[model samples]
Target: MKKIIKTVICIAALISAVSCMNNTKTLLPNVSGKAGEVIIVVGKDNWEGNLGNEIGGLLARDCEYLPQREPLYSLVNLSPGAFSDMFKLHRNIVIFNIDSTVVKQGVVYRTDVWAHPQCVIQVNASCADSAIVVLEKNGENITGAIEQAERNRVIANTLLYEESKLGDVVAKMIGGRVHFPVGYNLKKVTDDFIWIADEKQYSTQGVFIYKYPATDEDPFSEENIIARRNVFLKEYVPATAENSYMTTSVFVKPGIKFLKYHNLDFVETRGLWEVYNDYMGGPFVSHSFYSKDGKDIIVLEAWVYAPKYDKRQYLRQTESLLYSFEWDEDGNDGK
Candidate 1:
């Protein structure tokens, strides 16, 4: 029995490998849709009924930490009959097939169906009620997969941009490296603090990296993080007004969680940030972790200021930099 199980596992692995190869060789082009956009293919009848509500409620949920509420994904409702070659090339897609002929409910997730780097989710059910039940059971996982696909795309896009010396500088000074786009420039640098920003006409995107001695375990606490962040921002991120500086807002108190990513265990914080005496404010995210030597605590943060537009995409783009952190293992260099 054990031998049979092993053989089955090997066969499954072989099949998966072949599938991945085929997906790569696919003639379809890369996805053409924008980030945070999803195409939902459903019949017109069900598109406006309970079925629509379930799908929208799950995939179109609100994104957190944005000043204005925006759906997690910008959904495009397309009819199944109209799902031509054009629509199939979207980055994220969901097809809901509700018909009595579909005997049982099941979901099929296909990658690169009509484009490279794409995710296509198909839900089939014999009736509307059963479809709703299946969706409720698997909604979170489906949405998570879609979000991850976009994030991977963003990371890939970041690589296409020119590598900034800012990343190299950080590696040497802070004992870790974070990739930055070419447009980003070194805005401010001081003992134990580094600020990088890409300033545009109507928007500003920034990152803050700093380190402090790891005196105790309490430094990773939420309260301590907020306290320390305030000090760092106040000193480095001054506003236009006199004595005004950037600080985390207490009204919507920041949220923190412990997570492990890229082999580094860290605390993540998400919340709103406001100028101390000014009205300018937006969202900020941060990750706090320990250096390789275990003597210092490193904090890498990303924040955005786009008053006239939605911030979900901006936040995601900047957040990708935090995931790009790498530690130097050879000890010869930080880059």
Candidate 2:
């Protein structure tokens, strides 16, 4: 009788475990919308009023370092009534709920609400003015959330179709690993510098990885970073014309900002690059950070050259790869 009881208890536990797994499993559909697109849901009055203008200006502002004016995100505004099932599947969504009965008066961020890999930001306020205040207070957070969502999507796709060989090559060069999607090839590999690119007929997306000994001086300074970049480009990257090489453009000054991602602190620089003796130029961004041992400053830079098409998407795609970088000891080297 005791043996029979033990078997029954074991069966019951297995059944309970299966039940819990079923309860926790969620089968969400894939997200909709193209890369760099956002869906904004608001009332008609709010959409036409100052609150809408504020949201639009904040989210659709010009992307930095682009040669031509391009909004950071392509926004699509729809009224609350018009926000149907189809629109709920969008990758990025912001819903503004401003009514007298609203009990909550802040921003609430959610993910994978209606679709997989989606970002849904809901703002609840008592009135339009209050909504504007909330937005103003959390504007940077809002923008960052959506930007991260977009980047995560890119990183996901990259991992799905990753170029495993490139990770090995990068690991050997920099003592770290970076996930490179298919279509990219090793353009050049040297002792201290590595170049990987996806060259097409009309466009070129590339990444450069190099390291230098860290000094007591501010190695992450803009002047030093740019000087190092110019040196590397002049030596390794060349243009079609004789004596032409790539370098940072002096027409527009580069901007630098300190950012922390996944506990790694780095200085990000954004600017344009031009061929020294040629007319070709485009946008470029780089992240400079200390190596694992803090003895060297490693730089990962991404640049886009798409003279015939808009560069915002191209630049974002290439730039996303830089964020996928991981040190070998971090245990993501397989990625």
Clashes of each: 0, 0
Tens-digit per-residue lDDT, 1-335, candidate 1 = 99999999999999999999988864878788888999999887788999899888998888888899999899999997899988888899998888898876888888888898999899989887888998998898898788778877877777788465787778777777888878899988887999998899999999999988888669988888888899888888899999999999888978898988767899999999999999999999999998878898899999999998899999988987888888756562554
Query: Against the hidden true structure, what lDDT does model 1 obtain?
Result: 0.87
Model 2: residues with Cα > 4 Å off, grouped in runs: 1-6, 330-335
lDDT tens digits, residues 39-111, model 2?
9999888888999899988999999999999999999999999999999999999999888999879999999
Q: Per-model C-alpha lDDT, please?
A: 0.87, 0.93
Q: What residue pairs clash in candidate 1, if any at all?
A: none
Pick the TM-score winner.
2
CA displacement after TM-score superposition, residue 118 of candidate 2 (Å): 0.2
Off by over 4 Å in 1: 1-24, 99-106
